[model samples]
Target: MPLYLTALATLLLTALSLGPSFAHVLEAPPRLIVWSPELWREATVFNGQFELFARIGGPLDVAAMLAAALLTYLLAGERPAVWFALAGTCLLVLGLGAWFTLVAPVNAVLDSWTPGPIPSDFASIRLQWETGHMVVAAAKFLAFASIGIAVLGPRLP
Candidate 1:
């Protein structure tokens, strides 16, 4: 029961932390890919706002996952601790990895960009950034599914 409570708490925190980022993802990418340079510049300012939110929000997500992992380790007696740990860890890794490797670089590029001319490689960068979002979403979905299974698996007949 304690483990279930912890997992639920973690799940809720994850959702809270990710909610802003998800909003940005849904609204930003497709339009960004199509925007003119002047519009892109304006959008970059908006993106910066979300970046700040993400910076503030991401650590909370990681902390919640850590708490979940610790709870699973300490309280999951006779339950599949390994499964919970893997899911939780995978979620952390996928989110952080995408941010650092994929999103961050493109953000840096966008940050430095001026409003006159779009860079030649901007399309490719946008593709990579969007792809990173997709990958992160998929990983998160899998992790959530795995956690659900682990939490409920032993209760089933």
Candidate 2:
């Protein structure tokens, strides 16, 4: 019963965390093509507006990872299910790694900018940021699917 509850929590948290990442993925196409000034303005405005998301997403991301880990532990000795749980947890970790390595640096660069001149390498930065989010979104989607399999596979015929 406790294991079932934990698996449910893990699924919910993971799905919630995936929401922002998927939103970013959807935003990337329009974002990637805008003029430099427009991009800069959007980036700055978005940075200002993203605090709420950060506040909500940060904890959810951490909780999802923790919950997935716990689910993996609980499923130990359960064949196939345990493997899926482990894969899900690993994918979440890797998604976070991609964010820190790719997205966060770009964010730091954007955050450091003032209303003055945009950087010469703004395109490169934008591409990296968008690509990073896409990668994270893919990883998170897979993680959610894997965790779903972990929880439900055993019950299915």
- For candidate 2, lDDT tens digit of each residue in 1-157? 9898999999999999999999988887877775455665566445566776679988888999999999999999898999999999999999999889998898888777666566787778778888989999999999999999999997422
User: What tens-digit string does per-residue lDDT give for candidate 1 at 1-157?
Assistant: 7666777776666666566556656866655667765565566544564566667777766865676576557544544745665676577667767768877788777777765666788667767666666666555555566666655666422
- TM for candidate 1 is 0.75
Candidate 2 C-alpha error for residue 61, in Å: 0.9
Q: How much is 44 displaced in model 1, in angstroms?
A: 3.2
Measured on C-alpha atoms, candidate 2 has an lDDT of: 0.87
Q: Model 2, which residues run further than 4 Å from truth?
A: 34-36, 43-47, 155-157
Q: What is the total number of backbone clashes in candidate 1? A: 0
